[model samples]
Target chain A: MQLKRWLNNYVRIWGVYDMAYDESEGEGVWIYCEQEKGEIHPVSYELLNKGRELADDLNTHLTALFLTPDGSDAQELVYRGADRIYLLEHDNFNYPNEIPFRENIVKLVEDNKPEILLIGATHFGRSLAPRVAGALETGLTADCTGLKIEKGDFVQIRPAFTGNILAHISTDRCPKMSTVRYKEFDESERDTGREGEIIDIEPLEYDGPDVKILNEMIIEDINIQEAEIVVSGGKGLKDSQDFEIIEELCSTLGGTVGSSRPLVDEGWISRNHQVGYSGNRVKPNLYIACGISGAPQHLAGMKESKIIVAINTDPSAPIFDYADYGIIGDLYEVVPKLIKELREG
Target chain B: MANFSIIVPIKEVPDIEKVNFDREKGRIDRSSATSEPNPFDLNALEEAVKIKEEIGGNITVISMGPPQAEDTLRDAIARGGDKAILLTDKGFAGSDTWATSYTLATAIKKLGHYDLIICGEKTVDGDTGQVGPEIAEVLDIPHVSYVNKTIERGKDSIIVQTEVWGRLYKKELKFPGLITVTKDLNEPRLPTLTNKLKAKSAEIERWGLDDLLDTGDEKHFGIKGSPTSVVNIEVPKEKGRKSKIFEGKDAAKKMVEQLRKDLGGI
Candidate 1:
């Protein structure tokens, strides 16, 4: 295959930033655009939209770093606000692997010298961001919910101390980077009138590390982040086994099942299915809260849903404030009835 | 026999449940909160201890927190750490992950050689799982994040299982690499009486920026080196749910009808 051929004859620039580089200023807000299998994640567009504001504030270009195969879409990025696209096309680099991807992206960062770099804090970005930050020897803020340009610096705001406090971080270093959480901001409005340039990167002869990918199933596991409708439970569920009812409701409604931190702490559900400020910031079409008292932390995670329906026996439960519809009844009774209706529908 | 040089970089975070926000000050009132060794770091230490048990190795636990963090260091010792290093420098007060990683990496270089570095997946305080990989980069090594297990460790390479976006991947990396441990790595071993006694006498090494790094470069250690600043603090407003309460027999069906009318079909 073409990937096999390129892997053998690639070029390697090991530790390009190992030596100290002068504090030279660069102008541009760069977004690390990522894709899975081939589908471009919506977060990239959201970041591009966010980066455009920063680029405009800095009077610099808005660049999208597309490290994918050549077949990936380039038009959507420009319409979404990217002014320039740096395409690192390689057949071997279909999936975002941290090691080799870092080797390549770091090379580009060293060459281009972006002023501010924004990456979506998805599975791929989280793994890839540190390597780039490490190589560039610059500061990075992880899981940022807010990004703004104030007096010429990119200020990264994120909930710290596990949602107890927000820490505002700035990077005096070049290419101030932040891994932004998805669904925290609205996607940039698309416009076909926008235009951008796409530059192809030359082939790199770097081979994958000694570690081999034994089996990459790429299973489409359902989680809160990707769910259209989410059925969530809280401490009121009492026993972990009751989560099966939640699963049944979610499945019947054609969505994903989610839980609060206590459920996850009790090992009732995997961390992926957790919903809270520390967990996924989900923006599903419909969010069903069952027996959730709606702590401030939990509220931050799911309150942004388009429509919320809270089922709690307690009249004073906090979840009802953010919820569009509140059902004051026992979840065991309310949930099974809702499930039966959903199944019938 | 391959004895591993395993280093786990951990943090002592404020007890979040007790933390409160001061609306007047526009900042969190962290003074009243207790401190706990970040749980993720404990998981990393557990993974390190397990590797030590399976093979043969010395585990050096490291942290860059207030001197009060010595309690956390002792806890690490009580678990499985053979030695502990507390990088406490007044210069590191406001250091971000970048500066923190640089300081930790410089200290690691001073310690001579190491085969592996493990970090908790993320701290409950900062919640940024960046330091481990950042340190690897500063030290010019590869790293794996979200690691749940160390499947195998041969002479020159290690095999690990990492969860990425709800999918699991088994990775192999050469020595001198780093891996951040997830909370699921293993239930951390609680300190025993014997280990606690051993920990009590264990001398935790303390290093300031001047000891292991060039104290002159303000950009390498603390707030001077930190580029980001917390310009604003916003405490999310607590808006209670709808005050309406419908009770008795038909409440479930009635709620469903209202939900369907207002929220639309699922």
Candidate 2:
């Protein structure tokens, strides 16, 4: 006992003690605010809304780590919920490069030591978060659907085994981190009356192999996740050309076109139009499933929508189990008729 | 142009589509399902093989799993890999992305020389596209994710097309870099009969924690090295909704009316 006590004292004096779970060390909650072309990703605002609540639970301040080329307005982040902003402006931040971004973010986290770090699980966030976590040697949960503070522990909830199981995860290390999925939570209301502080962080010089962006192909922004109405198709379509009827119905309803994984895999539609566990998770106000048998993976993506209407010929289809309304009919006949009815009405 | 040495990391995952769920038991019966190479990892290996064909090079396939994962490595060898290595040990089980990446990076470092590494966008069972970038970070190399097409291969650099969000970017990265490929990269080829026969008798190098760890610290491996743990796992409760069925001729009209009512006149 005496030797163990002496060894503990020696380790503490030599600063070799394991600093894994020191509750007094880490402070504040941080959200990495991702921006593209001077516009912040909507998911960042959503995280800010959720981060604010988590910070309130921990009785700690909320900080937004904003790294942008043009130094886009940080005040909006403040109005949304962040108590402070860590602004890092550099021309290199224009494109999504993981190296420098990871370096700077890791340095900031090491310096400030935020207790909880949240990032949106976009393509960039998915790439950057892991690098940052690897550098810090900390744990990171990916594509979390829910996050909460329980008994002073930050708990991350995510789907495992292709959305069949939901796992509640916790990190033993400080700076508990998670990459939350988009559209999982609502954004906090912006209050112009709110005031906050913005601290400027000096950008670090990086000399690694640089990734140069030669050209950017402009693709139409298909923001299906933010759509109010979504009309999705599935294998029930006789041919790829049958998507025209689904498109007509979607156009008539002024909604977006979505498809099950098979249709997307068959090249009938683009991946952005896919709604499933592997594709986009959409929480639109109204979701219309045409000929979709509703596999568990597909249901996991869109079941959270306000209302779901399933159209299929088989009454025994699993879609009916989760659909708010079920229509037993051929989509080819039903979709065209629905379009005509909407046109006439 | 010099020949490139490419490394591809693949994973064996339970066939998620075929896995059965016991609703009463509130658990997934993964044992009933067969295991297969992660679909996207095949795309990564296909890209690596394509690169080897275009430019004279060697391909090394690596994986971390149980002893049975040797089958996955042999399959990769049959597919086009010139060599295969399996990093399997009892100490490497239950590793999160961080520990898994660290272990893979250590193995890659011990392998000596490589110009490029390729990985799938994500695993099917884990569904976390994290290990690739984490590996690159541990190695202090540049990485690009969601790469759909390889544009050009130069002496010391390569250009590729990647997608972020909804935009397509043409990016150029130096050698000794990593890329996580998407399904759009290319269709994987089936193993040839001759190659399959050759792979049946091929020797695969098996490495354990003792081989990779120089510090003799087992804490950097397996569940002990992992910082994250699943506290609880539960089958997601079905959010049952009102299943109002409409049939006959007015089904479409009824759906439209109900949608209009719920959405306050669409």
Candidate 3:
């Protein structure tokens, strides 16, 4: 106990974590406000609300780390939930390039010494957090779905081995970090009138190292993450010829078209269009399962939808148990008619 | 010098099926679970092996798990690992990804001389996919993730393709960097009888915390080295869907009508 106390005092004296670690007593919790082309990502807001809860529990403030090319997100970040905002603007930061982003974020955490750092487990964050954690010599839990305070420290809970199991993990050192998966937590309330501070930090000139983006191959598809309604087809669609029904219905419904993993395997759809344990986890208001047998793996992704409607030839399909609505019939006959009727109505 | 010097990090995760969450206790039950090499890591190893095949090179595989995890190392040997190092210690328990990365990074620095490090985007069990970049960060190397294809390769630099939704980023990175490959990159090769025989006799190197951390601060090694903690874990509670069943030809119209009403005709 004496040695532990000594180390605790040493951590504070050394201020190695920038006030982040005084052992059990934390400085604050910070959330990275992620942006794409100027628009803030939804996950950032979700994290802010969640981070606020954590900070409040610890009697600490919640700060926002906004690295952007412009001040577009700076104002909104304050109105959301952050008590303080660290806004860094730079040309390289316009895109969440791993190199400059890592360098800057690591410095921010080190200088500010927030005891906890939360990032969205989006493509960019996944790449950036590990690099930051590595540079800071701190622990970062990735893709966490649950976070809470235990004995004055934050505990992160995340899915392990894909969607199979949940692991409760902790970072014993200061600046405990975690990258939260999208849709893991509901977006919290935002009050535009909520006042907060925005500290503008000069962006250090960053010439990125070794890696460079040479070119890009673009394919337009629905942004499944932001979609409110998703219509998914499975192997029962048989082939692309039958998949047309799903597409047409999706278009008529003004929603995105998603598919089960089997359809991707059968070469009927691209991997991005897949929604399952191995694919996208969609939390749309309504998820329509057409000719899909609700495999547990498939359910792992979309079972969180607000309303599930399953259409299958088998009435005994496990999907019915989870679906708010069920239709027993072949998808081919049902989809075209549904599209035609919806188009008319 | 070898054409290419590489390291692949592997993990032995509990079987996906055998994993169960105890909501009441806020824990997972894996006692009945058999362990297997994290499938994603195999993809990384496979990609590294293919690169080595294209040009003559040596590959060193590393892992930090229990003693049983050594079996995963031998399997990597079967796949194409020329050297295997295992880091295991009682203090390493519940190290989380950061500590795990630290322990692994320490081992890598100790082994020295590596042109590249390949990792699965994530492990089946850890599912964090943070270690590869973390190691690169600790080593101060650049990293790119979600590469589905490698377009070009050479001794000093390489180009790869990242296929995310709506766009595929063709990126170039100089050597002595790290990459986390996805399954879409390539199909892994099955171990041949000869490689299996070789793996059976190949010796495995084991390192404990004492061997890795020069600072010798036990607190900076495993559970102690970690910063956060797991407060609780439970299976996500899924609300029951609306109980409305529709059937026959009229089902389509009726469902659409109901949806239009519920969705405010979006």
Candidate 4:
């Protein structure tokens, strides 16, 4: 991939303030963009959209770093709001192995010390960011719901206390860091015509042989994220038997099934089925909730689901606030009737 | 084929959740409560011990809190850590994520060589999930958070399996990596009596403001070095409402069918 340069002199505004302060005290913001098989994930773009504002507010140039295999699509990183792209490409990096990727990131960060680093809370970003932060001996915030700049520092804000509270944090010793969850903010349009500088570096290699993955099984069936129809239940179901009914309904509708935190906590469902702030964010064309009371934490996870339908005896349930269709009656009676009607219809 | 170094960050905070808050009094009644290692950090400790066993290496747990946090250090050593470091100073209080990250980065630098640092994705108290990444930033290292499995650790790199949306991803990163593991990473082991005995006299190192900065790095330490502050704190209101319980088997059956229909079948 060819590296491009933006040469935006506007960043010089912050440079002048730095001279007025202490030349030794300089900081910049970095965004960790994840790429796989020469493809930049959309989550990285979303993060760039968020990081751009933070960097601009902190008065620092936004740099995007992409780690991928050698001869991969590294050039594609520059068009995504990055003032600079640090590319580390290698054959080993073709498939993301945590050790090699993280080591390469350590080298990249040490070479370029940014004041604040933002990463998308995607699978790759989540797994890699923490270990690198630890190796560097820095603190990191994860799954940030909001971000802002206060007093020229990147203010990383996220939900705390089981999504019950919000906490704000900033770094002082330079290079503060945080990871933002997907869909946490709207993705800004890419300035495709905007060219930026890209620096290709060799991936850091580690020496070890203690672990190995013999093989992996790829299931092409279930695509929970992109499922067109989703059936989600919560703690309101109360028992395992109730779950069976929910499952039957999902089967009839040809939809995947999901649960609230309580179901996972109760071991009634695997965490894969959890739908909430700490769980999966789904946007099915049709989302159905059974017996769910609509706790904010649960809603936070599934509020994005389109055509939400809530079935509960409680007419004033919070789930109704965001739901388009509400059945203010017993789920048991309404469900069977609806099912028969659907079958006949 | 042997590479290992683990760093653990500790936090000591009041058990605000279980605290009996007197709304009218606008305070918590701290009469009956105790503190424990943040659940995620405890999981980190367990993961560290497992890694140490798999690949011979020393495990060090570090914390930047009050002197009382020493209890946590001792507990960590008791569990399975090879060493414990506590950086406690009154000036450290009210420090935001940035300051905390700064202090931790400084402490680890003072401690020296490391290959991998493991920590909880987020702490119970702060829950920002920033300290770990911030530390990575301060030291300028690579990191991953919310990992599910280390698919492989090769002589040259480590491959990991992490969850994204509803799918699992197998990715690789080089060594000297920092990772924040989730509770789902592994089932953390409980402490054994042998390790508990070894921990009793495990000379915990205590570093103060002066100890951290022989070079005046102290100027940008603790809350003073932190940029963001907690402008306001509010307890999230419980989403409670009127409830109705359906009675009888017929009612239960009806509810089941309705739920089934809601799910898209009968």
The candidate scoring highest on DockQ is 2
- Per-model C-alpha lDDT, please? 0.79, 0.88, 0.80, 0.68
Worst 10 residues of 4 chain A by lDDT: A14-23
Residues A223-296, model 1: lDDT tens digits: 66878899998988989889988989888778899888888888988887889866777889889889899887
Q: Which candidate has the top score in lDDT? A: 2
lDDT, residue A319, candidate 4: 84
TM-score for the A chain of candidate 3: 0.88
lDDT (10s digit) by residue, model 2, range A1-345? 597578667866764423333446789999999898667999999999999999999999999999988765888999999999999998778788888888888889867888889999999999999988887778999999999999988999998876777899998877788999988888889999999999998999977547888988776768787788999999999899999989998998899999999999899998889998778788888899999998977987798898888989898999999989887888888888889878877
Q: What is the TM-score of each predicted model, taking all chains together?
A: 0.90, 0.95, 0.88, 0.67
DockQ of 3: 0.58
**Runs in model 1 lying further than 4 Å from the true structure:** A1-24, A151-153, A162-166, A190-193, A207-211, A340-345, B214-218, B236-243
Which portions of model 2 miss their true places by more than 4 Å? Answer: A1-23, B1-3, B215-217
The TM-score that candidate 3 achieves is 0.88
Question: What is the per-residue lDDT of model 4 for residues A1-345, given as tens digits with 9 covering 90 to 100?
Answer: 122112223333333221012213546778877676556777788888887887778767888887766535555556667788887766655555456766777666666667777888766666566666655445566777778876665666776644555556554344566778776677657667978788877665566322233334454545566577888877667687788778777886778988887888778887777887556677777788888988766786677665677778787788877776666767677666556545554
i-RMS, each model, one decimal = 2.7, 1.4, 2.9, 6.7
Q: Give the Å shift of residue A262 in candidate 3.
A: 2.9
Question: Once model 2 is optimally superposed onto the true structure by TM-score, how far is the C-alpha of residue A338 displaced, in angstroms?
Answer: 0.8
lDDT of 2 at A287: 92
Candidate DockQ scores, in order? 0.48, 0.74, 0.58, 0.22
Clashes of each: 16, 0, 13, 78
Question: What DockQ does candidate 4 score?
Answer: 0.22
lDDT against true structure, model 2: 0.88
